[model samples]
Target: MANVTAKDAMQIHGRNPQHLVEKIIRTRIYDSRYWKEDCFALTAESLIDKAVELNYCGGIYGGNIKPTPFMCLLLKMLQIQPDKEIIVEFIKNEDYKYIRLLGSLYLRLTASSQDCYKYLEPLYDDFRCIRVKNRSGSLVRGHVDEFIDDLLHEDRVCDVILPRVQKRYILEETGEIQPRVSAIDDLLEDDEDTEKESDDELATSTRDQ
Candidate 1:
Protein backbone atom coordinates (compact mmCIF):
# COMPACT_ATOMS: atom_id res chain seq x y z
CA MET A 1 0.00 0.00 0.00
CA ALA A 2 2.90 2.34 0.72
CA ASN A 3 4.13 2.09 -2.83
CA VAL A 4 0.72 2.76 -4.36
CA THR A 5 0.01 6.26 -5.64
CA ALA A 6 -2.78 8.13 -3.92
CA LYS A 7 -6.18 6.81 -4.99
CA ASP A 8 -7.57 10.10 -6.23
CA ALA A 9 -4.35 11.26 -7.80
CA MET A 10 -4.70 12.52 -11.37
CA GLN A 11 -2.76 11.06 -14.22
CA ILE A 12 0.50 12.76 -15.18
CA HIS A 13 2.01 12.50 -18.66
CA GLY A 14 -0.90 10.20 -19.59
CA ARG A 15 0.06 7.59 -17.02
CA ASN A 16 0.67 7.15 -13.33
CA PRO A 17 3.04 9.86 -12.15
CA GLN A 18 5.26 7.37 -10.36
CA HIS A 19 5.81 5.66 -13.70
CA LEU A 20 8.04 8.59 -14.64
CA VAL A 21 10.68 6.78 -12.61
CA GLU A 22 11.48 3.44 -14.15
CA LYS A 23 9.89 0.42 -12.50
CA ILE A 24 13.26 -1.09 -11.63
CA ILE A 25 14.35 2.11 -9.92
CA ARG A 26 10.99 2.42 -8.23
CA THR A 27 11.32 -1.12 -6.91
CA ARG A 28 14.71 -0.35 -5.44
CA ILE A 29 13.28 2.75 -3.76
CA TYR A 30 10.50 0.67 -2.25
CA ASP A 31 13.05 -1.78 -0.88
CA SER A 32 15.06 1.05 0.59
CA ARG A 33 15.10 1.53 4.35
CA TYR A 34 14.42 5.24 4.07
CA TRP A 35 11.18 4.55 2.28
CA LYS A 36 10.18 2.00 4.89
CA GLU A 37 10.87 4.29 7.82
CA ASP A 38 11.18 8.01 7.10
CA CYS A 39 8.72 8.13 4.25
CA PHE A 40 5.97 6.09 5.88
CA ALA A 41 2.53 7.77 5.80
CA LEU A 42 4.01 11.07 4.64
CA THR A 43 1.51 13.66 3.47
CA ALA A 44 2.23 16.52 1.11
CA GLU A 45 2.63 18.93 4.01
CA SER A 46 4.75 16.57 6.13
CA LEU A 47 7.01 15.82 3.20
CA ILE A 48 8.59 19.24 3.62
CA ASP A 49 10.41 18.04 6.75
CA LYS A 50 11.97 15.19 4.83
CA ALA A 51 12.85 17.47 1.93
CA VAL A 52 14.52 19.92 4.27
CA GLU A 53 16.64 17.18 5.81
CA LEU A 54 18.05 16.04 2.47
CA ASN A 55 21.81 16.60 2.41
CA TYR A 56 22.58 15.79 -1.22
CA CYS A 57 21.09 15.12 -4.64
CA GLY A 58 21.50 11.82 -6.55
CA GLY A 59 19.87 8.69 -7.83
CA ILE A 60 20.87 5.07 -7.13
CA TYR A 61 24.46 4.39 -6.07
CA GLY A 62 27.00 1.67 -5.19
CA GLY A 63 27.30 -1.92 -6.41
CA ASN A 64 24.15 -2.73 -4.50
CA ILE A 65 22.28 0.13 -6.23
CA LYS A 66 21.14 1.97 -3.17
CA PRO A 67 18.63 4.81 -3.55
CA THR A 68 19.57 8.25 -2.25
CA PRO A 69 17.31 10.32 -0.03
CA PHE A 70 16.81 12.71 -2.93
CA MET A 71 15.47 9.92 -5.14
CA CYS A 72 13.38 8.52 -2.31
CA LEU A 73 11.60 11.83 -1.80
CA LEU A 74 11.15 12.18 -5.55
CA LEU A 75 9.20 8.96 -5.75
CA LYS A 76 7.19 9.90 -2.70
CA MET A 77 6.28 13.19 -4.31
CA LEU A 78 5.12 11.29 -7.36
CA GLN A 79 3.12 8.91 -5.19
CA ILE A 80 1.35 11.75 -3.43
CA GLN A 81 1.11 14.09 -6.40
CA PRO A 82 1.44 17.20 -4.30
CA ASP A 83 -0.45 20.34 -5.27
CA LYS A 84 1.11 22.36 -8.09
CA GLU A 85 1.14 25.48 -5.93
CA ILE A 86 3.02 23.62 -3.20
CA ILE A 87 5.52 22.40 -5.75
CA VAL A 88 5.82 25.94 -7.12
CA GLU A 89 6.60 27.21 -3.65
CA PHE A 90 9.25 24.54 -3.47
CA ILE A 91 10.73 25.78 -6.75
CA LYS A 92 10.69 29.32 -5.37
CA ASN A 93 12.34 28.29 -2.10
CA GLU A 94 15.69 29.99 -1.47
CA ASP A 95 16.40 28.51 1.94
CA TYR A 96 17.11 24.96 0.80
CA LYS A 97 18.81 24.07 -2.45
CA TYR A 98 17.70 20.46 -2.39
CA ILE A 99 14.10 21.48 -1.90
CA ARG A 100 14.32 23.65 -5.00
CA LEU A 101 15.92 20.76 -6.89
CA LEU A 102 13.19 18.42 -5.73
CA GLY A 103 10.48 20.68 -7.10
CA SER A 104 12.38 21.29 -10.35
CA LEU A 105 12.71 17.57 -11.00
CA TYR A 106 9.03 16.96 -10.27
CA LEU A 107 8.06 19.70 -12.69
CA ARG A 108 10.35 18.31 -15.37
CA LEU A 109 8.81 14.87 -15.12
CA THR A 110 5.16 15.99 -15.12
CA ALA A 111 4.77 19.45 -16.63
CA SER A 112 4.32 20.30 -20.33
CA SER A 113 7.28 21.33 -22.49
CA GLN A 114 6.43 25.02 -22.20
CA ASP A 115 5.81 24.89 -18.46
CA CYS A 116 9.07 23.05 -17.93
CA TYR A 117 11.02 25.73 -19.78
CA LYS A 118 9.18 28.55 -18.04
CA TYR A 119 10.01 27.26 -14.56
CA LEU A 120 13.34 25.44 -14.94
CA GLU A 121 15.09 28.03 -17.12
CA PRO A 122 15.12 30.66 -14.40
CA LEU A 123 17.01 28.26 -12.15
CA TYR A 124 19.99 28.55 -14.49
CA ASP A 125 20.83 31.61 -12.42
CA ASP A 126 20.86 29.56 -9.20
CA PHE A 127 24.56 28.93 -8.87
CA ARG A 128 24.61 27.43 -5.39
CA CYS A 129 27.02 24.51 -5.04
CA ILE A 130 25.38 21.09 -4.49
CA ARG A 131 26.87 17.71 -3.74
CA VAL A 132 25.73 14.82 -5.92
CA LYS A 133 26.44 11.22 -5.09
CA ASN A 134 27.71 9.35 -8.11
CA ARG A 135 27.00 5.74 -9.06
CA SER A 136 30.14 4.70 -7.20
CA GLY A 137 28.71 6.11 -3.93
CA SER A 138 31.22 8.92 -3.71
CA LEU A 139 30.09 12.48 -3.21
CA VAL A 140 30.96 14.83 -6.07
CA ARG A 141 30.90 18.61 -6.37
CA GLY A 142 28.43 20.38 -8.66
CA HIS A 143 26.33 23.52 -8.92
CA VAL A 144 22.57 24.02 -9.15
CA ASP A 145 22.71 25.73 -12.56
CA GLU A 146 24.62 22.81 -14.07
CA PHE A 147 21.92 20.40 -12.93
CA ILE A 148 19.21 22.67 -14.35
CA ASP A 149 21.05 22.70 -17.70
CA ASP A 150 21.09 18.94 -17.75
CA LEU A 151 17.36 18.88 -17.11
CA LEU A 152 16.80 21.26 -20.02
CA HIS A 153 19.03 19.59 -22.63
CA GLU A 154 20.13 16.16 -21.48
CA ASP A 155 18.06 13.06 -22.22
CA ARG A 156 18.65 11.57 -18.78
CA VAL A 157 19.61 12.91 -15.38
CA CYS A 158 20.27 11.34 -11.99
CA ASP A 159 19.51 7.97 -13.56
CA VAL A 160 15.99 8.91 -14.74
CA ILE A 161 14.95 9.34 -18.39
CA LEU A 162 13.38 12.76 -18.70
CA PRO A 163 10.38 13.23 -20.98
CA ARG A 164 11.16 15.00 -24.25
CA VAL A 165 10.53 18.73 -24.21
CA GLN A 166 10.63 21.20 -27.07
CA LYS A 167 13.84 23.12 -27.56
CA ARG A 168 13.76 26.82 -26.71
CA TYR A 169 14.25 27.67 -30.39
CA ILE A 170 11.30 25.51 -31.36
CA LEU A 171 9.11 27.20 -28.78
CA GLU A 172 10.27 30.61 -29.99
CA GLU A 173 9.52 29.62 -33.59
CA THR A 174 5.99 28.59 -32.72
CA GLY A 175 5.55 31.72 -30.58
CA GLU A 176 4.36 29.55 -27.69
CA ILE A 177 7.00 31.21 -25.58
CA GLN A 178 8.97 34.41 -25.95
CA PRO A 179 12.60 34.43 -27.05
CA ARG A 180 14.92 34.02 -24.09
CA VAL A 181 17.00 37.04 -23.10
CA SER A 182 20.08 35.87 -21.30
CA ALA A 183 22.32 37.71 -18.85
CA ILE A 184 25.29 37.14 -21.15
CA ASP A 185 23.56 39.25 -23.79
CA ASP A 186 23.53 42.17 -21.40
CA LEU A 187 27.27 41.76 -20.75
CA LEU A 188 28.05 41.69 -24.47
CA GLU A 189 26.03 44.87 -25.02
CA ASP A 190 28.02 46.60 -22.26
CA ASP A 191 31.28 45.55 -23.92
CA GLU A 192 30.15 47.10 -27.22
CA ASP A 193 29.29 50.36 -25.47
CA THR A 194 32.73 50.51 -23.87
CA GLU A 195 34.42 49.87 -27.21
CA LYS A 196 32.37 52.65 -28.86
CA GLU A 197 33.41 55.08 -26.09
CA SER A 198 37.08 54.18 -26.54
CA ASP A 199 36.85 54.68 -30.32
CA ASP A 200 35.24 58.13 -29.89
CA GLU A 201 37.98 59.22 -27.43
CA LEU A 202 40.74 58.03 -29.81
CA ALA A 203 39.15 59.90 -32.75
CA THR A 204 38.91 63.20 -30.76
CA SER A 205 42.56 62.93 -29.70
CA THR A 206 43.66 62.31 -33.29
CA ARG A 207 41.74 65.40 -34.53
CA ASP A 208 43.28 67.63 -31.81
CA GLN A 209 46.80 66.44 -32.71
Candidate 2:
Protein backbone atom coordinates (compact mmCIF):
# COMPACT_ATOMS: atom_id res chain seq x y z
CA MET A 1 0.00 0.00 0.00
CA ALA A 2 1.19 3.50 -0.70
CA ASN A 3 2.15 5.53 2.34
CA VAL A 4 -0.55 8.17 2.65
CA THR A 5 0.95 11.60 3.19
CA ALA A 6 -1.19 14.53 4.26
CA LYS A 7 -1.01 15.98 0.76
CA ASP A 8 -2.10 12.78 -0.89
CA ALA A 9 -4.97 12.47 1.55
CA MET A 10 -6.13 15.97 0.79
CA GLN A 11 -5.94 15.38 -2.93
CA ILE A 12 -8.33 12.50 -2.48
CA HIS A 13 -10.98 14.99 -1.44
CA GLY A 14 -9.51 18.09 -3.06
CA ARG A 15 -9.02 19.42 0.44
CA ASN A 16 -6.27 21.59 1.92
CA PRO A 17 -3.28 20.26 3.85
CA GLN A 18 -4.56 21.07 7.33
CA HIS A 19 -7.96 19.61 6.66
CA LEU A 20 -6.41 16.45 5.20
CA VAL A 21 -4.27 15.99 8.26
CA GLU A 22 -7.22 16.39 10.59
CA LYS A 23 -9.35 13.94 8.63
CA ILE A 24 -6.59 11.39 8.33
CA ILE A 25 -5.81 11.58 12.02
CA ARG A 26 -9.43 11.25 13.05
CA THR A 27 -10.13 8.37 10.70
CA ARG A 28 -6.95 6.47 11.60
CA ILE A 29 -7.61 6.79 15.31
CA TYR A 30 -11.21 5.78 14.80
CA ASP A 31 -10.00 2.63 13.05
CA SER A 32 -7.05 1.87 15.35
CA ARG A 33 -7.09 -1.48 17.08
CA TYR A 34 -5.49 -0.29 20.30
CA TRP A 35 -6.90 3.20 20.60
CA LYS A 36 -8.31 2.27 24.01
CA GLU A 37 -4.82 1.50 25.28
CA ASP A 38 -4.38 5.13 26.32
CA CYS A 39 -5.83 8.54 25.85
CA PHE A 40 -3.13 9.19 23.26
CA ALA A 41 -1.47 6.04 22.16
CA LEU A 42 1.59 6.23 19.95
CA THR A 43 -0.46 5.96 16.79
CA ALA A 44 -3.00 8.47 17.99
CA GLU A 45 -0.41 10.98 19.19
CA SER A 46 1.44 10.73 15.91
CA LEU A 47 -1.66 11.89 14.10
CA ILE A 48 -2.11 14.98 16.26
CA ASP A 49 1.57 15.78 15.98
CA LYS A 50 1.43 15.42 12.22
CA ALA A 51 -1.60 17.70 11.96
CA VAL A 52 0.16 20.45 13.90
CA GLU A 53 3.27 20.01 11.84
CA LEU A 54 1.34 20.18 8.58
CA ASN A 55 -0.67 23.18 9.73
CA TYR A 56 2.59 25.00 10.38
CA CYS A 57 4.08 23.94 7.06
CA GLY A 58 1.01 25.06 5.18
CA GLY A 59 1.17 28.45 6.86
CA ILE A 60 4.82 28.85 6.04
CA TYR A 61 4.39 27.73 2.45
CA GLY A 62 1.95 30.64 1.90
CA GLY A 63 1.10 29.40 -1.60
CA ASN A 64 -0.57 26.32 -0.19
CA ILE A 65 -4.31 26.17 -0.40
CA LYS A 66 -5.89 26.71 2.97
CA PRO A 67 -8.18 24.03 4.32
CA THR A 68 -11.70 24.81 3.21
CA PRO A 69 -14.27 26.03 5.71
CA PHE A 70 -16.03 22.75 4.94
CA MET A 71 -13.17 20.85 6.58
CA CYS A 72 -13.57 23.02 9.64
CA LEU A 73 -17.27 22.27 9.52
CA LEU A 74 -16.49 18.54 9.73
CA LEU A 75 -14.20 19.14 12.68
CA LYS A 76 -16.96 21.16 14.24
CA MET A 77 -19.25 18.16 13.81
CA LEU A 78 -17.23 16.44 16.50
CA GLN A 79 -17.79 19.35 18.86
CA ILE A 80 -20.63 19.39 21.37
CA GLN A 81 -20.83 23.09 22.02
CA PRO A 82 -22.92 25.09 19.61
CA ASP A 83 -20.25 26.81 17.55
CA LYS A 84 -22.70 29.15 15.87
CA GLU A 85 -20.11 31.84 15.21
CA ILE A 86 -17.75 29.53 13.41
CA ILE A 87 -20.56 27.98 11.38
CA VAL A 88 -21.91 31.38 10.46
CA GLU A 89 -18.46 32.56 9.52
CA PHE A 90 -17.96 29.59 7.20
CA ILE A 91 -21.32 30.13 5.55
CA LYS A 92 -20.64 33.79 4.95
CA ASN A 93 -17.02 33.50 3.88
CA GLU A 94 -16.92 30.20 1.96
CA ASP A 95 -18.29 29.29 -1.43
CA TYR A 96 -21.65 27.59 -1.08
CA LYS A 97 -20.76 24.78 -3.53
CA TYR A 98 -17.55 23.89 -1.68
CA ILE A 99 -19.34 24.00 1.64
CA ARG A 100 -21.99 21.65 0.29
CA LEU A 101 -19.33 19.36 -1.16
CA LEU A 102 -17.46 19.21 2.11
CA GLY A 103 -20.63 18.64 4.11
CA SER A 104 -21.68 15.85 1.79
CA LEU A 105 -18.33 14.17 2.04
CA TYR A 106 -18.26 14.49 5.81
CA LEU A 107 -21.70 12.96 6.15
CA ARG A 108 -20.77 10.13 3.82
CA LEU A 109 -17.56 9.33 5.66
CA THR A 110 -19.03 9.52 9.16
CA ALA A 111 -22.44 8.08 8.38
CA SER A 112 -21.68 4.75 10.06
CA SER A 113 -21.45 6.31 13.49
CA GLN A 114 -24.65 6.92 15.42
CA ASP A 115 -22.94 9.48 17.60
CA CYS A 116 -22.04 11.49 14.50
CA TYR A 117 -25.65 11.41 13.36
CA LYS A 118 -26.79 12.63 16.74
CA TYR A 119 -24.43 15.55 16.40
CA LEU A 120 -25.57 16.27 12.84
CA GLU A 121 -29.29 15.90 13.43
CA PRO A 122 -29.58 19.42 14.76
CA LEU A 123 -28.22 20.69 11.47
CA TYR A 124 -30.89 18.95 9.39
CA ASP A 125 -32.01 22.17 7.78
CA ASP A 126 -28.50 23.00 6.72
CA PHE A 127 -27.96 19.43 5.52
CA ARG A 128 -31.15 19.52 3.51
CA CYS A 129 -30.08 22.69 1.82
CA ILE A 130 -26.79 21.11 0.85
CA ARG A 131 -28.51 17.98 -0.34
CA VAL A 132 -30.88 19.87 -2.56
CA LYS A 133 -28.36 22.30 -3.96
CA ASN A 134 -25.48 19.86 -4.34
CA ARG A 135 -27.52 16.97 -5.70
CA SER A 136 -25.62 14.53 -3.50
CA GLY A 137 -27.00 11.16 -4.42
CA SER A 138 -28.81 8.41 -2.48
CA LEU A 139 -25.56 6.51 -1.94
CA VAL A 140 -24.33 9.22 0.40
CA ARG A 141 -27.64 9.21 2.20
CA GLY A 142 -27.36 5.45 2.70
CA HIS A 143 -23.97 5.85 4.25
CA VAL A 144 -25.32 8.44 6.63
CA ASP A 145 -28.08 6.16 7.80
CA GLU A 146 -25.62 3.29 8.13
CA PHE A 147 -23.43 5.33 10.39
CA ILE A 148 -26.40 6.19 12.55
CA ASP A 149 -27.29 2.50 12.79
CA ASP A 150 -23.73 1.62 13.75
CA LEU A 151 -23.83 4.17 16.54
CA LEU A 152 -27.12 2.76 17.80
CA HIS A 153 -25.60 -0.72 17.97
CA GLU A 154 -22.51 0.39 19.90
CA ASP A 155 -24.56 2.40 22.36
CA ARG A 156 -21.41 4.39 23.04
CA VAL A 157 -20.21 7.87 22.30
CA CYS A 158 -16.69 9.10 21.66
CA ASP A 159 -14.52 9.02 24.81
CA VAL A 160 -12.37 11.85 23.57
CA ILE A 161 -15.06 14.56 23.56
CA LEU A 162 -15.03 15.65 27.21
CA PRO A 163 -11.28 16.08 27.30
CA ARG A 164 -11.44 17.92 23.99
CA VAL A 165 -14.14 20.14 25.48
CA GLN A 166 -11.91 20.93 28.42
CA LYS A 167 -9.01 21.58 26.10
CA ARG A 168 -11.19 23.93 24.06
CA TYR A 169 -12.27 25.74 27.20
CA ILE A 170 -8.67 26.23 28.22
CA LEU A 171 -7.81 27.43 24.73
CA GLU A 172 -10.75 29.85 24.80
CA GLU A 173 -9.34 31.31 27.99
CA THR A 174 -6.00 31.79 26.24
CA GLY A 175 -7.82 33.32 23.25
CA GLU A 176 -6.50 30.68 20.85
CA ILE A 177 -6.32 26.93 20.45
CA GLN A 178 -2.58 26.73 20.15
CA PRO A 179 -1.21 23.42 19.01
CA ARG A 180 0.91 22.36 21.97
CA VAL A 181 4.37 20.84 21.46
CA SER A 182 4.10 18.38 24.33
CA ALA A 183 4.22 14.64 23.75
CA ILE A 184 0.87 12.96 23.17
CA ASP A 185 1.30 10.88 26.30
CA ASP A 186 1.81 13.97 28.40
CA LEU A 187 -1.13 15.71 26.83
CA LEU A 188 -3.38 12.74 27.49
CA GLU A 189 -2.20 12.53 31.10
CA ASP A 190 -2.84 16.21 31.60
CA ASP A 191 -6.33 15.82 30.22
CA GLU A 192 -6.98 12.87 32.54
CA ASP A 193 -5.79 14.84 35.52
CA THR A 194 -7.97 17.74 34.46
CA GLU A 195 -10.96 15.44 34.30
CA LYS A 196 -10.22 14.02 37.75
CA GLU A 197 -9.75 17.45 39.24
CA SER A 198 -12.95 18.64 37.64
CA ASP A 199 -14.91 15.74 39.12
CA ASP A 200 -13.34 16.22 42.54
CA GLU A 201 -14.00 19.93 42.49
CA LEU A 202 -17.56 19.42 41.44
CA ALA A 203 -18.16 16.95 44.24
CA THR A 204 -16.44 19.07 46.82
CA SER A 205 -18.26 22.23 45.78
CA THR A 206 -21.56 20.42 45.73
CA ARG A 207 -21.06 19.12 49.26
CA ASP A 208 -19.76 22.41 50.56
CA GLN A 209 -22.70 24.33 49.21
Candidate 3:
Protein backbone atom coordinates (compact mmCIF):
# COMPACT_ATOMS: atom_id res chain seq x y z
CA MET A 1 0.00 0.00 0.00
CA ALA A 2 1.23 3.48 -0.78
CA ASN A 3 0.11 4.48 2.70
CA VAL A 4 2.50 2.10 4.40
CA THR A 5 5.64 3.61 5.84
CA ALA A 6 8.55 4.32 3.53
CA LYS A 7 11.00 1.50 2.82
CA ASP A 8 13.94 3.46 4.18
CA ALA A 9 12.23 4.76 7.31
CA MET A 10 13.86 3.88 10.64
CA GLN A 11 12.12 2.77 13.82
CA ILE A 12 11.17 5.39 16.35
CA HIS A 13 11.16 4.32 20.00
CA GLY A 14 11.70 0.69 18.91
CA ARG A 15 8.61 0.58 16.68
CA ASN A 16 7.26 2.07 13.49
CA PRO A 17 7.01 5.83 13.80
CA GLN A 18 3.37 5.51 12.79
CA HIS A 19 3.01 3.22 15.79
CA LEU A 20 3.56 6.27 17.98
CA VAL A 21 -0.13 6.74 17.32
CA GLU A 22 -2.27 4.01 18.94
CA LYS A 23 -3.17 1.09 16.69
CA ILE A 24 -6.90 1.72 16.90
CA ILE A 25 -6.53 5.39 16.07
CA ARG A 26 -3.96 4.54 13.43
CA THR A 27 -6.45 2.17 11.84
CA ARG A 28 -9.13 4.82 11.89
CA ILE A 29 -6.78 7.21 10.15
CA TYR A 30 -5.97 4.62 7.51
CA ASP A 31 -9.66 4.00 6.89
CA SER A 32 -10.55 7.67 6.94
CA ARG A 33 -11.94 9.22 3.75
CA TYR A 34 -9.45 12.04 3.91
CA TRP A 35 -6.63 9.51 4.07
CA LYS A 36 -7.94 7.72 0.97
CA GLU A 37 -8.42 10.92 -0.99
CA ASP A 38 -6.42 13.93 0.14
CA CYS A 39 -3.46 12.17 1.74
CA PHE A 40 -2.78 9.55 -0.88
CA ALA A 41 0.77 9.49 -2.28
CA LEU A 42 1.65 12.84 -0.74
CA THR A 43 5.38 13.52 -0.59
CA ALA A 44 7.06 15.68 2.04
CA GLU A 45 7.25 18.60 -0.36
CA SER A 46 3.65 18.14 -1.53
CA LEU A 47 2.27 17.59 1.98
CA ILE A 48 2.83 21.23 2.92
CA ASP A 49 -0.07 22.21 0.65
CA LYS A 50 -2.53 20.14 2.66
CA ALA A 51 -1.04 21.17 5.99
CA VAL A 52 -1.69 24.84 5.28
CA GLU A 53 -5.42 24.14 5.11
CA LEU A 54 -5.68 22.85 8.70
CA ASN A 55 -7.49 25.06 11.23
CA TYR A 56 -7.82 22.64 14.13
CA CYS A 57 -6.10 19.68 15.81
CA GLY A 58 -7.50 16.41 17.28
CA GLY A 59 -7.62 12.67 17.19
CA ILE A 60 -10.85 10.71 16.67
CA TYR A 61 -14.14 12.44 17.37
CA GLY A 62 -17.93 11.84 17.56
CA GLY A 63 -19.41 8.40 18.22
CA ASN A 64 -17.51 6.92 15.28
CA ILE A 65 -14.03 8.09 16.36
CA LYS A 66 -13.49 9.79 13.01
CA PRO A 67 -9.91 10.94 12.60
CA THR A 68 -9.40 14.64 11.97
CA PRO A 69 -7.60 15.82 8.86
CA PHE A 70 -4.88 17.10 11.16
CA MET A 71 -4.36 13.61 12.57
CA CYS A 72 -4.34 12.14 9.08
CA LEU A 73 -1.55 14.45 7.97
CA LEU A 74 0.37 13.70 11.14
CA LEU A 75 0.23 9.99 10.37
CA LYS A 76 1.43 10.66 6.82
CA MET A 77 4.42 12.56 8.21
CA LEU A 78 5.33 9.62 10.42
CA GLN A 79 4.97 7.31 7.43
CA ILE A 80 7.28 9.42 5.30
CA GLN A 81 9.71 10.39 8.10
CA PRO A 82 10.79 13.53 6.28
CA ASP A 83 14.25 14.91 6.96
CA LYS A 84 14.73 16.74 10.27
CA GLU A 85 15.61 19.92 8.40
CA ILE A 86 12.29 19.75 6.57
CA ILE A 87 10.37 19.31 9.81
CA VAL A 88 12.31 22.16 11.40
CA GLU A 89 11.27 24.35 8.49
CA PHE A 90 7.68 23.41 9.29
CA ILE A 91 8.14 24.70 12.85
CA LYS A 92 9.90 27.83 11.67
CA ASN A 93 7.23 28.78 9.14
CA GLU A 94 5.41 31.47 11.12
CA ASP A 95 2.98 32.22 8.28
CA TYR A 96 1.02 29.01 8.93
CA LYS A 97 0.16 28.11 12.51
CA TYR A 98 -1.02 24.57 11.81
CA ILE A 99 2.11 23.81 9.83
CA ARG A 100 4.17 24.93 12.78
CA LEU A 101 2.03 22.78 15.10
CA LEU A 102 2.28 19.76 12.81
CA GLY A 103 6.06 19.96 13.02
CA SER A 104 5.93 20.36 16.81
CA LEU A 105 3.79 17.23 17.26
CA TYR A 106 6.09 15.25 14.97
CA LEU A 107 9.13 16.31 17.00
CA ARG A 108 7.53 15.26 20.26
CA LEU A 109 6.74 11.86 18.80
CA THR A 110 10.10 11.14 17.14
CA ALA A 111 12.84 13.47 18.40
CA SER A 112 14.92 13.22 21.57
CA SER A 113 14.11 15.07 24.78
CA GLN A 114 16.91 17.53 24.07
CA ASP A 115 15.79 18.12 20.50
CA CYS A 116 12.16 18.51 21.52
CA TYR A 117 13.05 21.08 24.18
CA LYS A 118 15.46 22.85 21.86
CA TYR A 119 13.01 23.36 19.00
CA LEU A 120 9.67 23.52 20.78
CA GLU A 121 10.37 25.62 23.87
CA PRO A 122 11.11 28.61 21.67
CA LEU A 123 7.48 28.48 20.49
CA TYR A 124 6.20 29.13 24.04
CA ASP A 125 6.01 32.78 23.01
CA ASP A 126 3.80 32.09 19.99
CA PHE A 127 0.61 32.73 22.01
CA ARG A 128 -1.60 32.47 18.93
CA CYS A 129 -5.18 31.34 19.65
CA ILE A 130 -6.06 27.96 18.13
CA ARG A 131 -9.02 25.64 17.89
CA VAL A 132 -8.69 22.19 19.48
CA LYS A 133 -11.32 19.53 18.94
CA ASN A 134 -11.64 17.10 21.80
CA ARG A 135 -12.72 13.45 21.68
CA SER A 136 -16.31 14.58 22.18
CA GLY A 137 -16.25 16.46 18.81
CA SER A 138 -16.47 19.91 20.27
CA LEU A 139 -13.95 22.63 19.46
CA VAL A 140 -12.38 24.65 22.26
CA ARG A 141 -10.16 27.72 22.04
CA GLY A 142 -6.52 27.29 23.04
CA HIS A 143 -3.24 29.11 22.71
CA VAL A 144 -0.17 27.88 20.90
CA ASP A 145 1.73 27.90 24.17
CA GLU A 146 -0.93 25.71 25.84
CA PHE A 147 -0.74 23.11 23.06
CA ILE A 148 3.07 23.07 23.27
CA ASP A 149 2.81 22.67 27.04
CA ASP A 150 0.49 19.67 26.69
CA LEU A 151 2.83 18.09 24.17
CA LEU A 152 5.71 18.48 26.64
CA HIS A 153 4.00 17.51 29.90
CA GLU A 154 0.89 15.44 29.16
CA ASP A 155 1.10 11.67 28.95
CA ARG A 156 -1.39 11.65 26.09
CA VAL A 157 -2.21 14.31 23.53
CA CYS A 158 -4.87 13.83 20.87
CA ASP A 159 -5.33 10.20 22.01
CA VAL A 160 -1.72 8.97 21.63
CA ILE A 161 0.42 8.24 24.66
CA LEU A 162 3.57 10.27 24.16
CA PRO A 163 7.04 8.76 24.28
CA ARG A 164 8.74 9.30 27.62
CA VAL A 165 10.58 12.62 27.78
CA GLN A 166 13.21 12.93 30.45
CA LYS A 167 12.44 15.58 33.01
CA ARG A 168 14.04 18.90 31.98
CA TYR A 169 15.67 19.38 35.37
CA ILE A 170 17.53 16.10 35.07
CA LEU A 171 18.96 17.17 31.71
CA GLU A 172 19.94 20.53 33.18
CA GLU A 173 21.63 18.93 36.19
CA THR A 174 23.58 16.58 33.95
CA GLY A 175 24.63 19.59 31.82
CA GLU A 176 22.95 18.15 28.76
CA ILE A 177 20.82 21.30 28.66
CA GLN A 178 21.29 24.72 30.13
CA PRO A 179 18.75 26.38 32.41
CA ARG A 180 15.63 27.39 30.48
CA VAL A 181 14.79 31.04 30.13
CA SER A 182 11.11 31.55 29.47
CA ALA A 183 9.70 34.26 27.22
CA ILE A 184 8.37 35.93 30.35
CA ASP A 185 11.91 36.43 31.53
CA ASP A 186 12.68 38.44 28.44
CA LEU A 187 9.51 40.51 28.86
CA LEU A 188 10.39 41.28 32.48
CA GLU A 189 13.84 42.43 31.50
CA ASP A 190 12.37 44.78 28.88
CA ASP A 191 9.95 46.21 31.48
CA GLU A 192 12.78 46.90 33.91
CA ASP A 193 14.71 48.73 31.26
CA THR A 194 11.73 50.92 30.42
CA GLU A 195 11.14 51.69 34.10
CA LYS A 196 14.75 52.70 34.60
CA GLU A 197 14.53 55.04 31.62
CA SER A 198 11.44 56.71 33.09
CA ASP A 199 13.10 57.06 36.46
CA ASP A 200 16.13 58.72 34.88
CA GLU A 201 13.96 61.15 32.97
CA LEU A 202 12.05 62.09 36.16
CA ALA A 203 15.30 62.72 38.04
CA THR A 204 16.57 64.92 35.22
CA SER A 205 13.36 67.01 35.22
CA THR A 206 13.55 67.50 39.01
CA ARG A 207 17.15 68.65 38.77
CA ASP A 208 16.26 71.15 36.01
CA GLN A 209 13.27 72.45 38.03
Best by lDDT: 1
lDDT of 1 by residue, 105-203 (tens): 999999999999899888888899999999999999999999999999999889999999987889999999997777678899999999999999999
**TM-score of candidate 2 against the unseen true structure:** 0.20
Model 2 local distance difference test score: 0.33
Which lDDT values do the candidates have, in the order given? 0.93, 0.33, 0.92
Q: What clash pairs does model 3 have? A: none
lDDT of 3 by residue, 51-140 (tens): 999999877798989999999999999999999999999999899998999999999999999999999999999999999998899999
Q: Provide the global lDDT of candidate 3 against the true structure.
A: 0.92
Winner on lDDT between 1 and 2 is 1
Clashes of 3: 0
Quote the lDDT for 19 in model 1. Answer: 95
> Which regions in candidate 2 have their CA more than 4 angstroms from the true location?
1-3, 7-101, 107-114, 127-209
By lDDT, highest first, what's the ranking? 1, 3, 2
Candidate 2 least-lDDT 10 residues = 53-62
Tell me the deviation in Å of residue 182 in model 2: 42
Q: Could you arrange the candidates by TM-score from highest to lowest? A: 1, 3, 2
